[model samples]
Target: MRLRKVMLVFKKDWLEIKRNHEVILPMIIIPLILSIGFPLVFIVGITMVPESASSMEDLENMIRNLPEHERNALSQMTPLQASIYLFTLYFLAPLFLIIPVMVSSVIAADSFAGEKERKTIEALLATPISDSELLLGKVMVSFVPSFMITVISFIAYSILVNILSFTMLGRFLFPNLLWIMLIFCLSPAMAFASICLTVIISAKVKGFREAQQISGMLLLPIIALMLGQIAGIIMLGPVIIGVLTLSIILIDYAVLSLSVRAFKREEILQKLI
Candidate 1:
């Protein structure tokens, strides 16, 4: 209920997070790779490969394997062009989702577990703040940084891709409606879901590494979605993305509600006994 107390907790966490290189490095490095490095490589590689090197038969055979809808979607583009769009744009969307999820998970995994590891949980719990305030503060600490990183990464990615491919595509081709929706609508929910699950696991686990390792399991579904997209089985249209966003929102709500219910200072205190 008290904003001041929440802000104090948030500020404390922020300071600690900045001092932790293990957390800070991955947060920076992964986004750079996902948003900048990979796209640069894919776009540059596609443009460098001679179109003459690939046969029409080869292109057609590859396109034939795609579903009818997918085939129609890329019907106008050459194989190399299609590969460029697919790799730099469509395929990277789900993979980029991993950035926020990982960022949130790493931080949330440190929420209570790190406190326990440092023998600081007792002091934190002894502070004059309600459990809800404590939880909210921790949630914000994880969610805000992760969300900002996701947004910044997406913007950087959009600029990198559009500028890099402008000559080839003839216009700004990055940030399609689906991607915009994915970033604005689905990403927060996904981050919240990861953080909530990680916090819950952190409270139950004994060490930061264990909590982080357990929370890493949240990426399995994301990896599966990435694979499905690669296989052309999952097309991320507005309708599909809307459904995905809704599903993630629901899951986030469920996990957060359960986490709050399960979060008892007594329980955590007993674990330390």
Candidate 2:
């Protein structure tokens, strides 16, 4: 693919995103709430609650079930400290995956589907861009922004978590290897997968709402992972992280290959008719 053509499409899509509040608003607002708002509330609430003996005991029992090294780390802290550590560090990890999934799906949902809404698909299809060039450009629109937002959100979350826990723990406890892997590896893979799925849906769906609704189904896995972690059934270790990243990468390749074939200019023009 020609870099010039891909950049041109990227630039055009970026400009359109800026003008279309429907597409851009949720992209920014959702991440802000997840990354900053929820953490702020959790940190503040934990700081205010006084440590009780019963609560401490329950927390201790839960931590004891964790792996040896993990249990040892939390065992050193007071009950309140342990509770905060559990929620901010461990519980929030899986839930963080939702950021990239949601952001990419939102943008990709708007791609061809939104163009259809605006009656612009024919003009877009008439352009001289090759099929691969077009697909790559559209994929990047969602993939790039979603990955960047995930990184930024992770940074914001890590800073907030450490700052809030520092008073109790007396040290920075975030950006650990697990978190680093999640952000740099697993998170981008998740975003890419979402982009490919949503792009495929957008090509066939007639409206942005329909495309978005279908793409939203991708969240089911992330939600399941979050629930599993809460129930102590799943853990985010290096091995699990590696497996998830590989799975997502394979799915992304498969979905993207199919999406490119399905994104035929003639099919899009026919839909526009």
Candidate 3:
């Protein structure tokens, strides 16, 4: 019964989403700018900036710019040293992860409030599914696609980052193990966290626009994280990043629980008028 109900709701929601250009356009545009266009543009700009045979123009002017023969010899350096270089390269890809998580959050935040705005909540509440089932179905609908898109975007961004960095630096510089952990592992947790939290916000808000504005406020931390990464203030190693991912995942679970508990059909119906 629960499975059928969930699928039924999912199908309905999917159809509705397909008809919403505001939702679809943002989902596509955010990744296009952050994952593909920005990285490609940045790489082109980086390559165009004339670097001497041995000078990197980043990080207090600290990018490795050794002679070609000298750089080839550094290949035999300690693993720790190599990891540091990889981490630096990985910094270029943070926008890819950050944008998708944020975009997902915004979408999730809109789901409930959007229904309220459209005056469709009363009908949704009148559906036979229990409140918990309905909430879970909505969550699954919002989260699953956002998470999948984020994963795919990361893969595409990694490929773009790699190709660009190699073309410019003559070596595959981005997407080290730390980045892999951050992008693939931590990113989904953060995405789900954002989605669940924003959905909770949506349920309480009056209109989709209001919910989106409020939800967008949550992105400040994400922006700060990206800026910090760019400024080289916070380096997320595998151990530290693993802890971060676990923390966000735990937060997501907690929010999911709260969303279900607080998601009363009565409230939705009460707000319908």
Candidate 4:
């Protein structure tokens, strides 16, 4: 339970993460695409398309279902302007969640499972760290980088969105309360949950790739959220984001607690044998 021992494990894993191209590539590429590529395409496409295009119908319908205040705000803009504003700020919001979950899952998948793959599990378990110290260290390894990546992605996305939309909207269009809550609150919770789940799966599985594949399923809920907002079935306003944040935090606590109880150095060593 000592912080010094926990950090020793954290430092060791951080070093491994830096050298693993499989882990580093996605961590870098995915955020770039989500922050830069996606927004650029959406903003340019929306700006070019005429208001009378049939594709505007779906966006219009989605906006109509928004709350009165939000609907009123969008109503002030031309269809093109509204489309760019809404899509960038809201419709694509859930995609940001993917960065954290994916980053954490990839690293957590490598935690113990990668040790087994590389034949290093015995050496790691032989260290003097207690089970709780080891578990917390692994959790921090995943959570720290994932959360940092999520924040940086959010900043990049926010800047790009403001720059892209500035000509049409005549104002900066990001860093609003909803997004603030999303990155600072819900994002960490989701990332922690993904890390814990992936850690558990990583320990139980036989290899890093297997653990990663299973952890990838964690994206289903985030994907569903994106679709729900687009379909007008749900909206990620302040209240909703707050609720989801609390729910995910509770889930994270429960999963982490379970991981601590169930994780055993000898059990993992036995699996390696």
Candidate 5:
């Protein structure tokens, strides 16, 4: 519907989100840990170990199992440099996917369930906004913040990664094609899918916590991606990222269409009674 009405609902929900510690804490903490803490720990640990440690067998195996082009790229680096590169780029990549889905689900879980919990659903529904306007507004609110957080975390991770590995690699090792496609393309699609699904869950559920718990199951796929890479079942190259991005976008379209059809303000109000 109208952009003005959509923005009004967006502003109102965003303001409430700011004061909500339950929502704000995860949004801030999770990104920090994924972007900075994990990288710092892994890189520092890699630096401390002597280059000759045979414990690197697992790492070597993982690298050896990578796709031909990837293997060729790492073939140039010394063992230490290659180890750092593998961990930072390939291993840690899926973890970044978690950030957007997690962030969006948390906020979208609060979209309507939080209203029901706080006994504010009636007031929200009483507003003059149409169903489409309301739905789009909530979707935007969740999508915008989650996407921004993912981008900012990517930037921070990129800088930290480049800086920490600079001594060993003698170059900036961040912002490669795979990562760029992963962040800019796949991340938003994933976030939108998570938000729309969570919004639907939020409408049906009784409380914010219940909605959040259900939405948390969305992490399963991302975890599978991470494990797949470790087991050498799959690798996230530029082509794979592009494919996943398009797939998720299509999923988002279907879920969003379903969400619009299912989200009836009158139905939600009836439940509140």
Candidate 6:
């Protein structure tokens, strides 16, 4: 592989990305709402609600309906706090997974489709880089930003969660095993999966919005996880998160293989109608 040549390709693309705020800013703005805004609202609002109110009374009834084994799980917290804390936290957890996946999809969709929209796709295809190398470069551009944003977002979220825990709960309540797996494992795999899939879609797609709309389907699993937790059908925990990470990794491997195998320059140039 020609490091200098690949670096040149990456550099030119980076400069192009820097100038294209129309394509870039939406990616960051969406993540802001998903990661920062929602967490702040949920944390502060929950702490402000009266613990002994009718809301808690209703929550207690629902808790009683849970299996004794599941109910035993929350023996760590007072009923009032559990109603506000664990109950809501369970529903909020999947947002972490979903946000990163969506961000990756946006970036990947833009990397290829944006080039096409700018009328630069044919020129980029004319570079000295082989098809595999060019594809690898595109993958790097998408994968790096997605994974980096996830890390930064996690840091921002941790600080916010700790602050809310101290100011509202009078202690730290975030950063448990479930979060550890969600942050370090499942989340990155999801990003990779989204990036790979979107790169292919974006290469074939002429419109960024179309690629983005189709790529948004990557959020389905996270959405389902959120709903399941809200309905009390499942709980977010280290064990469940571990299983989820493993399942995603397996799926990622299969999807990534398809991505690499399906990436054909001739086919891409001909366009997939």
Ranking under TM-score, best-scoring first? Answer: 4, 5, 2, 1, 6, 3
Write down the lDDT of every candidate, Cα atoms only. Answer: 0.82, 0.83, 0.68, 0.86, 0.88, 0.71
Q: Rank the candidates by lDDT, best first.
A: 5, 4, 2, 1, 6, 3
Which candidate leads in TM-score? 4
Comparison by lDDT, 2 against 3, better one = 2
Tens digit per residue, CA lDDT, model 2, 150-169: 89988888888888778778
By summed lDDT, which 10 consecutive residues of candidate 2 come out lowest?
52-61
Model 6: colliding residue pairs: none
Model 3 lDDT on a 0 to 1 scale:
0.68
Winner by TM-score between candidate 6 and candidate 5: 5
Please provide, for model 3 over 80-165, each residue's C-alpha lDDT reduced to its tens digit, 9 standing for 90 to 100. 33333433354544665577666676567667898888887878888789877777777777777777777777778767756754
- Model 1 pairs in collision: none
In candidate 6, position 163 carries an lDDT of 77
The residue-by-residue lDDT of candidate 4 on 99-134, one tens digit each, is: 899878888999989989999888788988998998
Please tell me which predicted candidate would have the highest lDDT against the true structure. Answer: 5
Candidate 1, backbone clash total:
0
TM-score of every prediction relative to native: 0.90, 0.93, 0.82, 0.95, 0.94, 0.84
* Worst 10-residue lDDT window, candidate 5: 50-59
Put down candidate 6 lDDT per residue, 124-223, tens digits, no spaces. 7776677667766777677767677777777777777677657646877567666778888888887877778888888788778888999988788778
lDDT of 1 by residue, 60-175 (tens): 54455455776786777676767766666667888667899998888899999999999999988988788878887888899999999999999998888788568666677766
